[model samples]
Target: MAMTMRKMAVVAVMLVLAMAAQEASAAGGCNAGQLSVCAVAITSGSPPSAECCSNLRAQQGCLCQYAKDPNYGRYISSPYARQTVASCGIPVPKC
Candidate 1:
């Protein structure tokens, strides 16, 4: 039973790693974690900083994807988030 449990754990870890790899590939070079710098601006209606703008611009292609994500959609679609993007000279994605 202990060996069976160990095998199951290994399988579970492998499955998780595989899923993570699939997600990374499907992300099309976009990593939402990079946008963490803009969290404060998005939630507080504060002006985005230079780093935030840079990351936003870099991840422009991924904005729609981010908006569609349940984890990030709320913030990505928020009025404050739009304002923050505009303040940084980035356009809010239609998606």
Candidate 2:
């Protein structure tokens, strides 16, 4: 039973990693984790860091999908997020 559970856990982790890879790639070169850099600014009205801005610009192609996410959509579409993106000199794509 212990061995079976361990195998199941491994499989589950693999599945999750696979799904995450697919989701990130689906954005056409966007890595979702890069956007996490802006999470603090997005949620707390803080200034976006240089890194955050860089990620925002890099992840521009993923903006539309981010906007539509049920959990994270609000943060991505919030005024703060827009400001953060613009502060980085990145235009918020109209999607």
Candidate 3:
């Protein structure tokens, strides 16, 4: 009975952690429009708009994945994107 209780407790903790992670992921950040705008600005070498900057700031945590992706890394790593991000004064994620 004690062993069963311990196993159930462990399972409960794991479930809680999983739920927390999912909730965090679902939190507002980058939305479809923001990504499209960012992609356009990055590809065109145009400056990012205020809205784009706001979204980027909110979604900073997800940007590292863009940096890591082979398809997106090129554009995300470009001077224009870097300059726009710097101009926005949004801190880059360390991830």
Q: Which candidate ranks first by TM-score, i.e. highest?
A: 1
Q: Estimate each model's TM-score.
A: 0.71, 0.67, 0.55
**Candidate 2: where is the Cα deviation over 4 Å?**
1-22, 25-28
Query: Relative to the unseen true structure, what is the C-alpha lDDT of residue 50 in candidate 1, on a scale of 0 to 100?
Result: 96
In candidate 2, what are the lDDT values of residues 1-95, reduced to their tens digit? 97686556435434433454467776567565667666667655679998888878877888887678664566678888788888888888798
Compared with the true structure, what per-residue lDDT tens digits does model 1 show for residues 1-95? 97686556435434433443367576568776667677667666778899989988998998887678665566678788799889988877776
Give the best candidate by lDDT: 1
Q: Is candidate 1 or candidate 3 better by TM-score?
A: 1
lDDT of each structure? 0.71, 0.69, 0.58
How well does candidate 3 match the true structure in TM-score terms?
A: 0.55
Model 3 misplaced regions, further than 4 Å:
1-33, 92-95
RMSD of each: 11.2, 9.7, 16.5
How well is each residue in 1-95 modelled by candidate 3, as lDDT tens digits?
97686556435434433443354466654332344445445544567788878877876777776566554455556677687777679865554
Q: Which ten residues in a row have the lowest lDDT in candidate 2?
A: 9-18
Q: State how far residue 27 of model 3 sits from its true place (Å).
A: 12
Ordering by lDDT: 1, 2, 3
The 10 consecutive residues of candidate 1 with the worst lDDT sum are 12-21
Candidate 1 regions off by >4 Å? Answer: 1-28
